[model samples]
Target: MTVALMWEARAVAGRGGELLAWARARELPRVPLRRETFRAPQDRVLVITWWDAPYDADLPELPEPDPELVTRAVHRWRFEAVDGD
Candidate 1:
């Protein structure tokens, strides 16, 4: 099975660009099958990592950035791909 890990964080007030850069520069624990980064309207940054592993496997994920840069705690989610190419 394939696991998709999603990480999201909203930067404080006007620090979106800095936060995004930080996220972009940060490295993941391991190289994923695929990775993607996104920016949202509310100064939100989202990173999605796809891994090839068992459904119940525990994978290393990116740690949250400095608290001062974000409005609140980072959000993370895991999903299993139902279909794929």
Candidate 2:
């Protein structure tokens, strides 16, 4: 099976650039099948990593940024591919 892990965080006020850079520079302990990063209008940074593992597998995920860098704790979710080509 394949798992997609999503990690999202909102930067503190105008520190969006720094937060985005932090996520880009940080490396995972293990490389995933694919990884992508994104940002939104609310200074929110989102990272999604596709892994070839079970849904409940212990996959590596992006950690929380420095407390001062974000408004709150990072949010994470895991999903299994249901239907796709």
Question: How well does each candidate superpose onto the true structure, as a TM-score?
Answer: 0.94, 0.96
In candidate 2 the C-alpha lDDT for residue 36 amounts to: 97
* lDDT (CA) per prediction: 0.90, 0.93
Deviating ranges (above 4 Å) for candidate 2: none
Candidate 2 per-residue lDDT, tens place, 4-84, comes to 999999999999999999999999999998999999998999999999888899989888898999999999999998887
Estimate the lDDT of model 2: 0.93
Q: Once model 1 is optimally superposed onto the true structure by TM-score, how far is the C-alpha of residue 60 displaced, in angstroms? A: 1.7
